[model samples]
Target: MKSIGSKWMVVLFVAVGVFMLFNGRAQAAYPEKPITLMVPFEAGGGVDGFARALASRMEKDLGVPVVVSNEKGSGGRRGSIALFKSAPDGYTIGFPHIATLIYDDTLGETKSPVDYSKYAVILRVDTATFFMYVDKKQPFKSVKDMKSAGQALKFASTGIGTPSWLIPSAVGSAAGFRTSFVSGHKNLAEAALAVARGDVVGGTGSYTHFRGVIDDVRPLVYMSDKKSYHLPDVPTIADLGFGKLSTLGVPWVIVGPPGTPEDKLEKLRGVLRKIIQQDEFKKWGLENGYEPDIMPPDVFWKKMGELKEVYLGLKPQMQEKK
Candidate 1:
């Protein structure tokens, strides 16, 4: 009886040991399969282009295929929610704008499908500066001229609540201009083409995204205080009059679903850091008109917190949409 009892205990111990080993091996062998990268915008847009490029490089570093899935709607909220709802395994991740991530809660837009706190921030990949462009045929050469005209100008944005919309709205409110906003485009390309054709007098969004259409439209001013590297000749809003109203470049962030293991998150972050630092990635980003402003997880989180405060302060002005 004593020998039988001892034998039973030995079997149980071996089973427990085997289970622990398997668990550790599973945890360490993260991203064993192809990873899905969700892009919350339509394909062929600037964000989509950037996501594809980053994914292509990341696959080389990670040794796994990174697939980009386009989930468009609700100003990028639909896909964001989907990404959040996905399993916390490292296989599922998302690339979303910083404004969409921070302002979703404050704007009462939609309950984030993913808990931001649970996800690991891989890195801040890029900052795209929005430009205020007017058709070259328009009489107003500069913002001062347009402001002095005092007539309401028609402006087109990607949508009502997007940064492309909000930045122009903020500028209009601060500069005390009667600006009318028209929505309906999926991204800046359509709106930019509309502005270039004189369907809309002005447009706003990343200058790089619109650089291809600059021949038809002339940039009036930058939305931010600092000048844009892509359009260095153009003056910034601060260079005009509305110093307090100037905004910064929108940051692009890569995040995994909540409950992703720390080690897995660190692995993603490590690959991203390496990719961002690579000369090929940097050159490609610059050539495509993106600034390589990579930030680590801790710093990126702090910036997200700060940007939330800034967006909240602008919420009141955002209500008075024309």
Candidate 2:
């Protein structure tokens, strides 16, 4: 009887040990299900492509499927709102620009459930300086010619509060010209297409959007202190004498909903850090006009804060144009 009782106790001990081991493994498994990546733009555009590429690479490292969902509207507001309002289970994340995330919220134009401050930015994939593209059919030969034309010109913008409109408006204010905006284009490609088709006199967006139509449109000036590597001949807005706004560059961030677990966030950051370091991702970035610099969470948030302040100072000017 004593030997039988001892055998029963040993069996119970083994069962408890097995249960503990499985529980530990379960707890460590961060992404037990597929992850959804939210892109706040139309499919087949630059941002969507970036999301798809990033998702593909992340899937390998995470051991789970990464899906890209396009939540197009309000120049990234719709997707960002959805991301922030999602369950904090580390499943849904968003890729949104800081400017668009804060645009409507800052201006009080409409009620927003998610403020830019609420985002837990995990990584910064790239940055783009604004560039102005003119219709190839237009008589303007260069930035000089465009400035010399001295006529109120139409510029295509994604919407009222988008960087597509804000950058051009700011440049117009600083450079002493009048700009009439053709707002409500869905994406940067649409804005570029409008310029290419002569639907608008010109348009403003990052190079990624304009690169495809480089032959169809003339890149006059980029809002950078130095000439872009891709557009070596084109002068910068600073060189064109609007040096004040030359520092503006839109950063693309990967943000998770607030209250995401720190461990999960770290896991994401680790995977992205590895992904961006690969030669394939680097080559892809160069080809796609994406700057292959990975700003980690701490640095990204700090840069975002500075950018927010700069935009806040520039917001009043943007709003007056409305």
Q: What are the lDDT figures for the candidates, one per model?
A: 0.78, 0.81
Evaluated against the true structure, the overall lDDT of model 2 is 0.81
State which candidate has the highest lDDT: 2
What TM value does model 1 have?
Answer: 0.88
lDDT of 2 by residue, 1-322 (tens): 9999999999999999999999889869989999999988889878788889999999998999999999988777878778888888889987865676665666536756667777887888777777887899998776656566567778998887778877777777666666888888888888898899899889887788888788899888888888886777888987888776775677778889888887788889899999999998899888888767888878877776776666677767777777
C-alpha root-mean-square deviation, candidate 1: 2.8
| Segments in model 1 whose C-alpha atoms lie over 4 Å from true places | 1-21, 107-119, 241-248
Tens-digit per-residue lDDT, 261-295, candidate 1: 77888898888888888898888888987777788
